[model samples]
Target chain A: MHELTTTRNNYQIDPVLTVWGWEIPVYLFLGGMVAGMMIISGYFLFKGRQKEPTCSCFYVPWVSLILLSLGMFSLFLDLSHKVYVWRLYTTFKIASPMSWGAWILILVYPVIIANIFIRLPKFVTDKFPGLEKYSKMLTDRPRLIQNIGVANMILGALLGMYTGVLLSSLGARPLWNTSILWLLFLVSGLSGAAAFVHMVAKNIYERELLAKADNGFLTFEIFVIGLMFIGLATSTEVHQEAAQMLLSGSFAPVFWVFVVGIGIIIPLIIQLFAVNHKIQHTPVAPIMVIAGGLILRFVIVNAGQVSHYLNAHF
Target chain B: MARFAMVIDTKKCVGCMDCVVACKTENNVPEGYNRDWITQEAFGNFPNIQLEIRSERCNHCENSPCVSSCPTGASHYHDIGGVVLVNHDECIGCKACVASCPYDARFIHPDGYADKCTFCIHRVEKGDKPACVSVCPTNCMYFGDLEDPNSDVSKLLKSRKWHTLHPEAGTNPHVFYLT
Candidate 1:
């Protein structure tokens, strides 16, 4: 016979850091990626580059709908009262970022559909005679098509910035309470989208153009990230600690290895070399960019939760 | 037109966690989650150390980020005393309020909506004290309408030296701690 005993692990409960989880960062990643794709697609359409098979305008809207739906599904999974999700549209609270996001998404669907219509491939339009009439309406009015491109660009930019503004407005998490977060997220989205297009581009000229654009966006992203750190470090003590979470604390490894090293710098260096013909273009760089972009959101969301006003140290 | 608040006397607190237990029992707080809890902090070095015990919960802020961040008006102020309450029926469980709260007072209830201390409004409405206040062995917790000068909380504020958690966060918390 043996005496039975129970053992317990003595982990302190962090009361202030319990509300959010993994679903948030995944949703942010998907939302940002969709915004990026739309912007790329919009720009190509605005420039009247629909003839190229590799032009994002041809397939971006279809792809965007699928990606956005996936992102919304992730968000829906996070909700506790899934049946009550319809209540979000009952009325808009102007102060609420969540409200703005809901409305923006509603607006996004139609714009994406119109964009897809604008760039409808001939084979499909020929198959459906009714679709050709609508496609012709877009082709007949160059200004209408241009206005649609502008609308997508504006909507896409707003969607990208909203993802960051959503976090920054929290004010509770020092890591997220920065004005620079929106710019960083938007630029990251653009770069991510550019990398995605670069990978799938069938035309050499389009691929090269996107590669160059991604490189530019990457450089700007580095600057925005640096500015964010500087802004945080210069603020109150708690804000400094929040910034340190990325600079030297628990999140440092992820931020440096995944976000900065593999995500930004490696891809940047590869693209630079490829541009000079020192190396051939490979999917490796673009894939790394996409991975880094996703990791950036994860790091921000997770690390932001860990950063708070009062804890054991206080 | 009442503005309710809680004043906790840290000196009288024994860290026995009775208030925590009482709150859970009264509120039916889910397993592995808490509506209120205790936090212990040790200040100074080795021999000169001062140990502090705090009973922490939602401040029900006058400038609550959670309220403004809520998309569907699920998190709103009650009409009677400006108490922040959640309409679970309207909650989409987006967790915007959870992230926006600086004190980290709110949690996603297992039922899938944002939940937190209601200051025991159900009891307060019935002219009863909150469970934590009624059960505190050390008599450390004080609750009343801050707008009423006759209320015990207002008198205590007038007599004691008190501070709020994270004043710099600027939510202007209704909860106060007397050193």
Candidate 2:
């Protein structure tokens, strides 16, 4: 049989082509989750102990640490020469968002680690006196820790929003450049954070402990999802192209199945059942909501990057 | 002072990519890399078609987004003739400027520096035309000082109907293409 042949040029005909692959979306998801967790934890920390400090406060630091490390690792993997990536910090430039993000992560990581260490149980702390002393030092200076937490919150918020802005700044890539992308990213981040917390709580805590933790986060996530949809629908042509991909283009199946089906609608339906049954205090609904939120982040990040500017014209 | 510029006559261009090869050779552009290239838009399927071929390169814009986005001041417009050049020593290779360029003019070189068409600044400084202008078989590429009335580029600007890529970007690129 004669072979069907297609010749691909070494040269890219499209000027807007990018080498930014899976790393970009991974970075976005990680940044969103980190920002979300930091915000939720900061809110609870500043507002005093919630119904369950074990799940909301103590678990958040560990989860944030894991996500932050994973995201940073993925970022390194995205680089062409991953070994030389450390040089980015030495010759920093303020105009580059990546540079800004790199510095922010450096500052944020240690504080998160410190926060996590301090909140550990006395048995663990007593076994390691040096660690226990360090924990005590941070706890004794509550104001310093508070300031650190506030900075983390503000920086985390920017980190979350900046991922969208980073994409938006490429005005030529009509798929990315938009004023509303930042808000969409922020809402998604919060949703991802809520989902992550729900998952972690489900894995670690008993049924009684889960019931004590607030289920209100599900309602908040639904509201945010609605806002994200509205923002996507009303944006400009480039953004419309990206949004359309979610609705009907190559990204539609994933967007519909994962983001809408699993993340938004499923959680909403589950929460409705819980509320109607007067099971507002239950953990099952929030757990489902959180699963949906994680899946939403996965779908959006992958979908956003899959469609390129040149692809739109062709 | 003379403002350096290029004038391309699209009708004369055969889409041979001679200029693309000439540019890479002159610039020491890395293997599997390019400093300039051509794009073709063809309509109405094979055997009943019309084609438009355009040479593409960094425009050396008056308001270059690449320069603005470079966090380390590595990519900057030259003071002498407004040619954009990257300082290899200072570039962090974050590829921010690469992403910022509207025409996809810039690339992150293997040496971890942002690289693009410099309008052959070294040759221009030595009173020579860009290699692409000198090497083009059909005489499609013209380079000269835009400020001098006698210069070919300036005269062409006055005489021909021309356009630059992405005029809406307000970069006022030095390169002009005759349609």
lDDT of each: 0.86, 0.68
By summed lDDT, the worst window of 10 consecutive residues in model 1 chain A runs over A1-10
Q: Candidate 1: where is the Cα deviation over 4 Å?
A: A1-19, A51-54, A122-128, A311-314, B46-48
The residue pairs found clashing in candidate 1 are A80-B112
DockQ of 2: 0.29
For model 1, the docking class works out as acceptable
The digit string of per-residue lDDT tens for model 2 on B105-161 reads 777777666788989899888888888888999998998878889999888889988
Task: Name the runs in model 2 displaced over 4 angstroms.
Answer: A1-18, A50-55, A83-87, A120-128, A137-148, A202-240, A275-314, B1-3, B28-32, B42-51, B88-93, B107-114, B147-150
Worst 10 residues of 1 chain B by lDDT: B39-48
